[model samples]
Target: MFWFLLIAMVVVIAAVTLAVVGGGESDVLPEAAPQHLTDPLPLTRPVARADIEELRLPVAARGYRMGDVDDVLGRLGAELAERDARIAHLEAALAGAQATAADRPGAPGMFDEPPADRPGDLPDGSGERGEDR
Candidate 1:
């Protein structure tokens, strides 16, 4: 029985080795030839001196200037005050113009009487008399 088993094992090993060695095969094809290609042309231009000088000009010459932080704040405050005064003056002028219009003789519906329930008893219906209704 030992001799029979040993012979079978040797036969199996030999068959496996032959199968592995004979299974490999190589396939080869021809290599492709190279083709010529052209390079792209450059499309850039140099800047002129005048262009550089224009870019270097100061901002102040273009009607803008930088001030110190405090100076800018002060100027802003002054401008706001001026605007407030102008607004007040305009409001006063508007009130005066309204008064003058109300006083005009022939303005359309300008002299119309006030309703009975109005707050004041001013004789001219102008509320200037300051009397309680």
Candidate 2:
């Protein structure tokens, strides 16, 4: 009778464990599913500095794929740095040009400041000079 009772208890415990633990299937979404969190972002517009800085990725069962995320962030940082440097260089060039024009003798009032609407003719170097007469 004691053996019978012990066997019945073991069966009850096994049944309860199986019922509580669900099944062998993982609760996490599969990596390959279309609706999965790994979908690529559509970069239709340029990513702003704040957008990149505030970016977050979904966490998987083992957390995010750190190496991949780090690589992308590194690339974004480099690109942002390059853009900032280029903007600074261009601004300095414009300031230098304005200063040079201001210092020239008989310069027009426009020399010390940039016009609100810059004319496109300046880039082609097509200004009418007396030599062309």
Candidate 3:
């Protein structure tokens, strides 16, 4: 009886292995994704929030397809790099402009200061009407 059970288990394992490995009777293998052959990301422009929100990735046996995720990540990395470079450039330009403005102290700034001719006016920002202590 034990020998029979052992033989039965072996046969079941063999059958499963053959089914998984594709026995000599079949040469074709299942494709990972045959329907969605192309990626959904747009090639002409940088990816937007709407694009990511609308994007759908293919699913594999384990999880989302590796290639599809890789492509999306690569595109996002590129977009971030471009934005970072642009930010750095603008910051540098702003710094230069601020430095140039600093060279002149008497120049009136964008905000208006309190009038010195006003009654009880003081250089300090306090609007006090009390005695000057």
Summarize candidate 2's per-residue lDDT along 1-133 as a digit string, tens digits: 9999999999999999987786666764466732233534336655666765566675556877676577667767777898899999999998988888778887764544554533434555665544564
Alpha carbon lDDT of each predicted model:
0.56, 0.68, 0.77
Q: Model 3, poorest ten-residue lDDT window?
A: 30-39
Q: Residue 63 in model 2: shift from native, Å?
A: 2.5
Which pairs clash in model 2? none
Q: Clash totals for all models, in order?
A: 0, 0, 0
TM-score versus the correct structure, for each prediction: 0.31, 0.47, 0.55
Task: State the displacement of the C-alpha of residue 88, model 2, in Å, after optimal TM-score superposition.
Answer: 1.2
Candidate 1 regions off by >4 Å? 1-67, 109-133
lDDT winner between candidates 1 and 3: 3
Q: Rank the candidates by TM-score, best first.
A: 3, 2, 1
Poorest lDDT segment (10 consecutive residues) of candidate 1:
34-43
Q: What alpha-carbon RMSD in Å does predicted model 3 have with respect to the real structure?
A: 6.4
